[model samples]
Target: MTSQPPGAHLPDHPEFLWRNPEPKKAYDVVIIGGGGHGLATAHYLAKNHGITNVAVLEKGWLAGGNMARNTTIIRSNYLWDESAGIYEHSLKLWEGLEEDLGYPILFSQRGVLNLAHTLQDVRDSVRRVEANKLNGIDAQWVGPDEVKKLCPVVNTSSDIRYPVLGATYQPRAGIAKHDYVAWGFARRADEAGIDIIQNCAVTGFIRKDNKVVGVRTTRGDIAAGQVALCAAGHTSTLTDMLGFRTPLQSHPLQALVSELLEPVHPTVVMSNHVHVYVSQAHKGELVMGAGIDSYNGYGQRGAFHIIERQMAAAVELFPAFARAHLLRTWAGIVDVCPDASPIVGRTPYDNVYLDCGWGTGGFKATPGLGWCFADTIANDEPHPYIAPFSLDRFVTGALVDEHGAAAVAH
Candidate 1:
């Protein structure tokens, strides 16, 4: 058989980007989970705080879980002020992330449109646009005609089941190569003398009275001055080991992609009413996804009915998508909070930080949270941007609810 030329269909995969190091006996910090958030935090810890004595432990391969499974849509058109502040900060960081990391992340800021279907969606979209504008974020409400102009493939006619009413447009919003983003952060962190240890799962915590002194891992016990939890879906397991509850429910969130086609989809389009989000990836596949599964579980796969609903919504929004063959479908276990907002602050135990409950917004908030998380870890104080999302907010009844604007949570 003739040799194939590097599988032109697949996205360029980086090989041996970072060294696989053995866990040191002790470090100034030990970050659990080597996903995008963990890697970003590690990069910022060394770059911003000058803290290079750190180790990022991963249960599996780097970015092999939710980081690899997400649909890769990045936007900051959130409704609330707290949500807008953090997400918009993330969006700004995304703008210069490639240069800062000294790697090509393939970030495309083509734009994103959050479609409004009914009168309620239209009202909410307009309100969110105004809210975004008030928060210094670039957002505007566009009618169906304008939506059709932005993405020609969209069916804006009123005859559809969920007719296109209008949409909230954020010109700075877009998607990036998820794998490239993770690799970029990992490489930079690894180069800074931070250990990136894969397959090193944290079996338990080594704690003194009200303080986490170290961690017990699969490889061996490693002492730490501070321990940060970035485990995403498995955060509850870690917290359970520490004898505390975070009020997070883990669920399977699924997404899929279609066979590569000519770039017909111009930009990312999300509809919360119908519960389907679509965007054509850099590789030309139509990426699609919807909400999490109804039940709580750690499984990285969802029920067939969820995928069926997602496809139906996709077909209804873009008639042309019905003919495209499905390339593949996958899921990630996302730990969601009661208020649909993330919890990022000091845990009940001293020297232990909490960074979970991002739900579907984890990928978008990677760099921004990393920047702030590094500060939080370095100074032992919550950054102002993430202060409102403290674990104590639940007890204080000061929730930053983002269910309506979170899109996928619908």
Candidate 2:
């Protein structure tokens, strides 16, 4: 047997990554949501900004929300510069994240293939590949034969419903163990003295004039010098208290996995036309995800038809999957913006920072968003990478609009 690469091994019984601290009476910074984004932000706040007086309040267990529910695909082959900037930055950080956090995240560079099924898809995909290359991201367009060579399980037959004309391949794009990624950040942040308070839901905001001074949580009212909203789907619930509405809609993004199987799939494959994304986990489960549900809801469970439809597409793409037994299905509530991009800047309240509307890109953008958001909260200025994602962009009509590049439908 060969030795595993650094940060690629997981112990059978992992140690606790963080403590179950009680909510403090007040903190210099109060971050809502203890998922990947919230935990990463706290990690950066302590590591980068020297802001250890921070509290990450979560309604549920850490990383148990969308962090555990996501498909864990990481890539930066986007159409727009803003999208590419943040995502590529995140991908670069992911390359060194395990060493930085001093924990195992099991990050793999197995690459990703975004298939193009139609003539228009081919044109758009090739254009995005050029855009990615121009932005210094590793990307290229591969024909059907190349796709087959990369992932032999893929059915590149022209007679299929959505024939694979070609695909944009990102050689560095892959996946990490979502739970371990969050735990690594959480452990580092906790070691730096940042409080990870779980089961403390932020019920409302405490404001002094135009500034948010604290939050009312189930634990109690806690004072804060600054409030950062890193809550994913439940962001609007807190934002509504600020009296301004974000042009966002919440939907349940569904994913499923198959029983343990032999390693047949070696890379991530996503098809916008077929509305499915497939990747094999390091532990042998065939992880798969489909487009978000059409209805506006926050349930962790989605309609069975959505699962049935995605499996149909999966079988067509990988015929061997037709006999795979489904392990389980789950959903994550994602807040989608009208322009298909995120909003990550100042809100109506002076001391409150907004980081929502990530839709399907949350897990991939965790570290990059956390790094930039910590800077935004520390220096009280928008990070250049996230400047284009400010809430004002919606009103100013300067939307990033990544519908075509967001991969999974929103």
Candidate 3:
């Protein structure tokens, strides 16, 4: 037998610079997922709240879940005040995230354009833009000519079935290297002495008198004072095991990238009417995606017809992409809510918290979600940022629906 170092080529495994250590029998808090959100939560719980006794338990590799599976679009030009507030807080943290974490997340500030293809889309987008501006969110409506200027490669001509009438542009909105986000947070969280337990699948919760005290995992029984369920798409499973129910349903969301190419698209272009959103990555690949599969399943693969429809729309919107070779495709399971928003607050269990139902918007929300969630866990109360997303909203009917999310559902 031979020893291998981190990043050793296969037949060997690649490990993080700060790999997961042995699971402790107990911790102050245990976050059930090691995605960006979980890592960020641990980091904030240590860095911000000074609650360093934390454990992030993952069934797989860190950030290998939906955190790294998204298109990496970051924006907070939501229509409602609640949606805009939390996202804007996340966006602000994103502006300083790299510096705060001491890691290069490759956060870009290019721009994001949400196209309006029909009369209703235009009307709704205009209203959404107005609401965003009223809430002090940076958002503006660009006419077809300006939309073409922002993204010259786009087909704004009226000949197409869904011609671009106008668009809502958020100049601060852009994409980042999604993988580095999780790794960066993990590195910092590990430095804070928070345990990162990998390949440790949580089997069940340890509850006494209806209060969760710890969890049973494949590794061992690790008791904790508090637990945060950042399990994302698998939230229902954990909630089920803990004897509770939520409206969250898991669905497979797919995305694909084209072979590397010369920089053609300057900004992110999204068209809900066409059902395709595309952006040029820092590597010059045409990164694109569409809505989720119509059916719900735990499968990480979506129906081919849905992808075919997305490709058709892509070619229709960007004729230049017609020749771009499709390199690869993949999917991530997302936990969707009926309101197309997220749930981030206390669960029924007194000692358990939740950060799930993020569905399409988890990646962009990593920083803000973690910050507020860590506060909620440490203080035993929801912060103003996550107050609207409380589990009680389902009963109070205080849902904060954003019309901007009506398109591509993110």
Question: For residues 68-159, could you state the per-residue lDDT of candidate 2 as single tens digits?
Answer: 89999998888899999999999999999989998888889999999999999988888988988899999999999999999999999999
Worst 10 residues of 2 by lDDT: 1-10
lDDT, model 1: 0.90
Model 3 over residues 213-321: C-alpha lDDT tens digits? Answer: 8899999999889999999999999999999998888999999999999988999988888899999888889999999887988888999998899999999999988
lDDT of 1 by residue, 1-410 (tens): 11112322323444456788888899999999899999999999999999999999999988888898898888888889999888889999999998998777888998888888888888777888888889999998899999999999999999889999988888998999888888889889989999999999899988899999989999999999999999999999999999999999999999999999998998999988889999998779999999999999999899999999999999999998889999999999999999999999899998999999999899999999999999999999999999999999989999998878656532
Q: Give the TM-score of candidate 2.
A: 0.96
Score residue 408 of candidate 1 by CA lDDT. Answer: 57
**Where in model 1 is the C-alpha error above 4 Å?**
1-15
Q: Could you arrange the candidates by lDDT from highest to lowest?
A: 1, 2, 3
Candidate 1 positional error at 360, Å: 0.3
Off by over 4 Å in 3: 1-16, 403-406
Task: List per-candidate RMSD values in Å.
Answer: 3.1, 3.0, 3.2
